[model samples]
Target: MNKSMNVFVIIALVMLSGCFPSNDLEKKQVHLTGITMGTVAYNIKYIEQPIDGGTPIPSDVVVHQNVERILKQLNQDMSNWIPDSELSKFNSHDSLSPVKISEGLRRVIAESIRLGHLSEGKLDVTIGPLINLWGFGPEARPEKAPTQEEIAQAQARTGIDNLMLEGNMLTKRIPNLYVDLSTIAKGYAVDLVAEYLDSISAHNYLVEIGGELRAKGFKHTGELWSVAIEKPVSTERAVHQIIIPKDNAIATSGDYRKYFEENGQRYSHIIDPDTGKPINHKLVSVTVIHPSSMTADGLSTAMMLMGPEKAYAFAEEHKIAAYLISKSENGFIEQFTVEFMPYLK
Candidate 1:
């Protein structure tokens, strides 16, 4: 796992759960892969389940269009890069009054708030100011670390408490509040697509966006969906582990590949909203499995920010299945909650 998986999920070469089907469904399998969500690409493999009694699956073109439609709407609603996106417009709004928002945006923001509290504000969606200050956002990178006063000013502009939601409306106590769903939006989008496949009677499927992924049913061969966990190394791509999701969602967050090294110190793109600075911890990556991709997404990010010891404790306390990799004097160390032992190969 790397920052690409956390930031946008740009790992396209590794097919974590892209499996083949049995002889019966071999020719019926429909696989779709393409770029979306600004930079990352999505890979989906599914077989349309029988409809009514024995009705055949719709043409591949129809399924393609349907999935594309869903993703396009998500980008329109949550993309911070799009000037006219729902999230961007919300950020541009200077009024304190509640603004009417789409149901989808409201749901995503609502989940983000819950996670913000769960991680003690470490998994903030309204952290655009601080992200920009550290040269990770739309702003250009600064030559040196931000001054203490500058960090304080950015901190003042952020906080999960600053945002409020009522019904289908959203409100920002401070007008300049900006929201970026980079941490979890891809997973949310993956979930939405999975829901669509379910609606169309897809009996078996694997949905992956960037590196956030979810799988369901079997491969038409009686095997559960298997995915690869990446080794936390920047020089090359290698599998750290292979595990079956057992009809669940999985998300991994790390920064081995996307960070700056200066004066013998490394700076991760993942910001600690509380500190208003990049995380400097030894923990390198976090992998979480959950029923909901959105939850797994947020949990992975939050755990990464917590470092190793605290993350392991939190995962155990919450009974979450988590795998953590951290830097060591010699090389790296591995630890996972007991719940994760079941998924190990």
Candidate 2:
């Protein structure tokens, strides 16, 4: 096993001392490889079922390489911007013919659109035009803030409602609407990595991508993996941590991560679909934990756009656990739902 995996295994054993049936353990790290939609990494750790000691290094190294390859394919194959990508071709043709798509692409898009509707169109995949108009991502940077007219035009062409799913084929209701899957692609990739780990009988593992995390079973120490929530603006460290003990996924969305500075002002990439403008909420970050990574992933963005108060209320109404860190008039304020408070370890 690699040094890092060794350390995690030690931690897991210590945590499991009281919970697990036996002290003898065989820990192995598997580094999976493969790239499908974008960039992804799976840090998987598994305990030998019969306590049979085994090598952890070579197996882990191979797994890592496999995961990388999968992510690469996903990025190229599903990108909507690429005219030859599966997604773009599906959108280009107006016909409702059943088109076969990569299972990964189909699953992610279906989940994204489902979450968009569940959030009342708060988390939209068709915000690409608006995202580009605002100079985010690969879209050209606007020299200055776009006029209200320009913003409205982009907004008119963007919406989750514009997506039409017929049989195995996907078509856009709006002629020029383009779909951007960035919001949920990372989480979907994490989900795929988790599936692969399970297929290999790797039970204790945690997968993370760009900050989104999904942990199953226990950490190397035998205790639940403790993931820290980074303070907004402080990428080097986490302000709080959540200990994972069960099968759950967590995703945090904030304006601090992706932004551009111009004329002494910082503009975030997160845009409010309803307003057709960037979100100016005082929230620093929002962490959402739920059963599905897709839901946890998209809800975090929606919560950021909804602001603290509304976000909190939404979480409460849906019985979802959420942790919101906001910029108060004085300093920072942290709020959590009743269900989420317990995870604030």
TM-score winner: 1
Give the best candidate by lDDT.
Answer: 1
Cα lDDT tens digits, model 2, 1-345, are: 001100011121112222443464334434333334434334444443323333332356566666666666667666765678777676566554456777777787788888888788888888888898988856579898888999999898888988866545676676777788888877877777777666666666777766677777755445565666666764444344344425788889988878877788777899889988888878878888886777788889888888888888888888888888888666667777888866655
- What range of 10 consecutive residues in model 1 has the weakest lDDT sum? 1-10
lDDT of 1 by residue, 82-119 (tens): 88999889998899999999988988988999988888
Q: How high is each candidate's TM-score? A: 0.90, 0.84
lDDT of each: 0.83, 0.70
What TM-score does candidate 1 get on C-alpha atoms?
Answer: 0.90
Task: Pick out the ten consecutive residues of candidate 2 with the lowest summed lDDT.
Answer: 1-10
Name model 2 segments beyond 4 Å from true. 1-21, 30-58, 80-83, 91-100, 234-236
In angstroms, the error of model 2 at 3 is 39
